[model samples]
Target: MQINRLFEMVYLLLNKKSITARELAERFEVSTRTIYRDLDILSSAGIPIYTSQGKGGGISLMDNFILNKSVFSEEEKNEILYALQSLSIAQSPESEKVLAKLNGFFDHKRSNWIEADLTPWGSGKDSQSSFSKLKEAILNRRVICFEYFNAMGESRGRTVEPLKLTFKVYAWYLQGYCRTRNAYRTFKIARMSDIVLTEEHFEEREIQGGLTMEDDETSLLSLRLNVTADSAFRVFDDFSETDIQRMDDGSFSISVKLPESNWLIGYLLSYGDSMTVMEPKHIRERLREQAEQIAARYQ
Candidate 1:
């Protein structure tokens, strides 16, 4: 906290040309004696800070002082600003303040190079609220409770010690220790609801590694599909360019390995008649049966 105060103090003096020790003390909620001590520390650290007792004289940095430009190269300064700019996506006010100060201190204008939004398309405010709450719980090392829905569509109440928030495979997931199951589990954010940040605090656990998506390679099925030209946009959207082969007729052939599951069948059905399963006879059969069931319901 003192380091933060010291850094902000330097920025303030740099911007205002002169500020009273009383002003710095009030700004940082410290005593004037503490502010004087900080001034000493800054001076000892090779900062050109001095104070004059006369009227209109307070704490000031030498007029020639610019945060030693040689300490960070031009590119390094831009990179630092860009990194802080990215944190703006989370709407962190502290980061925004620090970013502004650093921008002025470095005397560099940051360009709008990138934009990121974590909320998915069509998602309402609840999604953003849940993300913010989970982030808070993680930072404070507090337990969280929520209703979670699994792939089978079963809903259950869960009390978890949230460890990390991750984004992978086009979705956000919370990796946490599930008190209900007594083990570590990853819960999809969209499948979570009624989240409550519990008062219970937790100690940091020795997590082995980052979130891992475990799949049995031996059980995976190599899927190949012939997508008509009408679904060309989707083909490129969902599959990598290396996996897609453009056909002479403008249609595309794609090959990928995926686990055979009801979810896979449902995904194929989403393409409707625009896609045909060219291999794996069992998947094709499964798709046909699913289609027939839908038709029966309509009839």
Candidate 2:
């Protein structure tokens, strides 16, 4: 893949000190034009890469430029390698190869200290394919079309310029500019289907804040939840120990801040009777109404 080749090219320039475009092409088994494009990609990403033409001129990084000031330090190098190793769980071939190259460069053997698998439990082949496609679209700045199911169970077609693929909580989200909405929006990858990569390209728009992992202070709701002992495993898994209080009665009480959204409502409802919303009466009432509606449906 071109991404892998681009990474290898950097690694090569680091080790060989310098190399001609033709030599890089031969090494990668690609055309000189393709090699130049790869070099452009590296340069655009702020890698300080440049081409010099003349006697003893070739592709190389800026002299005296280390990968980063801290990158050569053993602890920092291991931290970077560990981060890459975690990212490789997504089955990103480029990241895996880059990790291998970095390991060799640092003369460090790979350690299985950390593992990050973003895919949900029991996720199938389709999930992997969707993730791979989203990654490609985001990288290529390509527009993509897909059918999306929204929170209220409404389905619609969306044409968006894929910008970022985010793995948050237990699901994957795509942050993109939606042509239909004329706004930036986040789409849950699980709710998307028939995803098609369009030939049409979009000018990269500066992404305004849309969906982010950081909780917005203005919209965040401070919550208190009292949970039965039976829900301790779920509570501990989702909340940090600092937010959790073990009650004298062996129950668990958690104080946390969450972004106010319908998803939060559904999440809280998932606990059923095992948990009680101790504060935020509005949220509790909403869940109560929904529970009543669910009971009505069963009746």
**Which candidate achieves the best TM-score against the true structure?**
1
User: lDDT by residue for model 1 over 104-130, one digit each (tens)?
Assistant: 778878677778777889988988888
Weakest ten-residue segment in model 1 by summed lDDT: 209-218
Off by over 4 Å in 1: 1-6, 12-66, 210-224, 240-262, 278-282, 296-299
lDDT string for model 2 (1-299, tens) is 77678778877888887899999888888899998888788888888887788999988888886775444678888888988888777678778879888887788998888766555689888777888888889888899999987655567899999998777766678998888777788888888999999898889877797554221322778999999998888988899999999999999989998877777889998898999998999998999898999999988
**lDDT per model vs. reference:** 0.84, 0.82
- What TM-score quantifies how close candidate 1 is to the native fold? 0.72
Scored by lDDT, the top model is 1
Model 1: C-alpha RMSD to truth?
5.0
